[model samples]
Target: MIAIDNILVSDDVVREQFVCDLAKCKGGCCEDGDAGAPLEKGELDEINAIYDIVKPYLTPAGIKEIETRGRYQYDREFGWVTPTIEGKMCAYGYRDEKGVIKCGIEQAYYDGKTSWKKPISCHLYPIKISMTKEGEVVNYEPRETMCRPGCIQGKKLKVPVYVFLKEALIRKYGEDFYGVLEQVAGSYFAKAEKQNK
Candidate 1:
């Protein structure tokens, strides 16, 4: 594990490669999970605040689910999460013209209708975060089947998971933290390369 401040980042985060191949996976992560995307407590308010603006970007089914179930729901396992469409796609998600599932909230953000992009959890996908008594534990947790394309693409492109998730990490931690992580990753890879020689 690489210790950055109080956070403990799993080695896989630096070793394993991953880049979301949305075209191939068709945004399966938004729909395949048992529950909606995990939400931080503060994000609940953000969702509620932006729901009206994001609504038009969503699908009819998603809008109905959100309207009926509320903007977000509580899950025993995941605590707060976006409501799912009949236990399938997320209520905040919609299928694009290409039939790929996409986050309505993100689309709204891209369109400049909202400042918030989406949930941090959604942005930090493939890297699950857990708050421990000591600090935050960050782990690489890509879905084996659904993330295969991304994994392959990452390896082919030689993009480590940390690099691929640089933006999200910076957003979650901060630029300073990301810079330290990059230094750690550089040392980690260099040592491995030397050992292989």
Candidate 2:
């Protein structure tokens, strides 16, 4: 587990243009919940404590997934991903009436209610957690591919960093992580500006 309370985004334009495709992309990562994510030792203990309280609503599968796949720390050699669960959607992933894949934990968090009794990894998406040898924490941006050409081209407009960092980014990674991420995003913006010029 890493203790990255901050991320340093290298570009402002990239950050502004970046809108996570929660509805459109529906990356499988969201479905798995925190169980599909890595955690630090203390973070796990905290999550388990929460799990003990919410065990009833949590599925046996969700618990199993978290236990089996829960990474205590980042394995740089393999990269920051867990082994994909064979042919299974994340325990928290379900289709709505319109047949849209939605995340259960995210819904709960936003609605101010408790979701499954599992690790916090299930709640966070797009933001990845990793640890360095000195135990420094690191967070990675989500990997999203361009979906609609119009959506890709539309991002040429400029907006404030606060929009992404203070709002969406904070909602996902907490204030600490966003602080560092904004720094990284700033650098990205500068480089993008240079390229554009």
- Candidate 2 per-residue lDDT over residues 1-197, each given as its tens digit: 21243333333223434334446654545443333445445554554445444334335665565567652334555333332234355544455665455544445545556543233444333334444555433343444452232234335434343443355455545787667655655776789789999
Residue 4 of model 1: what lDDT? 90
Write down the lDDT of every candidate, Cα atoms only.
Answer: 0.92, 0.46
Give me the runs in candidate 2 sitting further than 4 Å from their true place: 1-16, 31-35, 52-87, 115-125, 133-141, 144-197
Which 10-residue window in model 1 sums to the lowest lDDT?
90-99
TM-score of each: 0.97, 0.50
Using TM-score as the measure, which candidate wins?
Answer: 1
In candidate 2 the C-alpha lDDT for residue 19 amounts to 37
> Where does model 1 exceed 4 Å of error?
none
Name every residue pair that clashes in candidate 1: none
Candidate 2 similarity to native, TM-score: 0.50
Clashes of 2: 26
